[model samples]
Target: MDELSALAARVWGELAQAVSTRGHPWRTATLATVSPEGLPDARTVVLREWDEREQTLVFFTDARSPKVQHLQHLQHQAQAVLVLWHPGLGWQLRMTVRTEVTFEGLAVTSRWARLKMSPAAQDYLSPLAPGESLQGLSPAGASRPHFAVVHARVLALDWLSLNPEGHRRARLCPPERAAWLQP
Candidate 1:
């Protein structure tokens, strides 16, 4: 395998280890994407889950959010980068992954529901459209409700990370294409 690919595998393994030991990445990562006009937009969000087995990463956002729209349109040609900073290790894990949007599976949805969270998390999922600006006191304040239309489905993913170390940079290469480097 090429040096670049080998380094990537090493860095990816490090990140997978960190994710397993820590429930989430250090903080939310900045997810970057390009618009059809070639403009790039990025936002910081929590990494809800990561599936190293499937080479899959997961996050949640409002279905009507612009980022979700951009991801849906760019799924074919786009790549995503997840930067996980670790001060203890003095190393960061830069993961580059191919982007794919999907709804949470029964397992994932159940996990979300089961997490111990503030009341707002549940109310935020009310039937209201996700991305719209609220006019005033949203019904969100009046009632707590569980929704199926929650289109909680904006569950999209971006793929990719880079390792600056000589043997750590990785791309969104195929899963079986992984090779180990001497980092």
Candidate 2:
């Protein structure tokens, strides 16, 4: 394999690790998207799944959340950026991805099955929509209807390493293109 392929493989490997490794710095990424009003919005989100073959990343969110509404407003074809940093490796990865949202399909059902039994399920159980004012300890709803899954197809990846000796940067457009960039 050539140098660029090797580097892309290494970066993909770390992204896969971030999915299953709790507390991994890359396990939580900042998701940046454009709101319905055309303003940029960003928030930290847990990394749920990664598929190297498909070049896709996954995360769960409330169906009524602002992020979901934002994606819907854009017709789910808009591009979003995910930024992750690995403190231990001194590396940062900025990925440009196409977003898709699933609510009631098998994709949502299967993930909800696994999550509904865990404490994390409470995140989607709130009676009020995200950003709505709470009314003093309101009881959570009993179902998982609010759960939604976001599947992001990575279109491009920009990787940067902050090494003590020398910094390096690279960009990968996957399946075919990769190039080193000046840092």
Candidate 3:
């Protein structure tokens, strides 16, 4: 492989390791999207899956969530960003991605089946959609069709490593572009 390919592979490898490592804060990334009003919305979401070959990342959410609507509005302009910071490791990854929402079909069905069997499935069982105010906590409900899986196709990966001596930063854009940048 060429130099840029190797660098991209290494960056992806690090991200894959971070997501797979239990208790690592990197497992949770801040997902940022643009609201219909042109406002920015961000929330912490769990990293569900990472495919290095496809250069994609996955996250789960309720289809009725506001973010889902934001994604729909994006459509062809479905650009989003995911930021991951690991204080212990002193590494930060800011990823530019094209987002795709999957509510039905094979991918969603398989994920829903697996999630339904896991304790985390409770998140998708909410009677009221996300951001709704409640008088009290509602009992866990059964899994519903609102469960969705979001796939993000990586467009660019900007990695920053903090160090006492000197910090390092690198940018990797798909198909064969990568370079170190001034930190």
When 2 and 3 are scored with TM-score, the better candidate is 2
Model 3 pairs in collision: none
Candidate 1 runs further than 4 Å off: 1-27, 104-108, 116-135, 141-183
Error of 1 at 48 (Å): 2.6
The positional error of residue 131 in candidate 1, measured at the CA in angstroms, is 6.3
What tens digits encode model 2's per-residue C-alpha lDDT throughout 1-183? 988888888888998999999998999999998988899999999999999989999999988899987777878377899999999999999999999998887999999899998999888888788898876755758464589999999998999999999999988776566889998
Q: In every candidate, how many clashes are there?
A: 12, 0, 0
Candidate 1 similarity to native, TM-score: 0.58
TM-score per candidate: 0.58, 0.94, 0.90
- Angstrom error of the Cα, residue 130, model 3: value is 0.6
Candidate 3 per-residue C-alpha lDDT over 1-183 given as tens digits, one digit per residue, 9 for 90 to 100: 876567677767777876678777778999999999999999998987899888889989998999998888969888889999979868888999999999899999998888787888877888888998876867766446579999999998888889998898888865556888898
Query: What lDDT score goes with residue 20 in model 3?
Result: 79
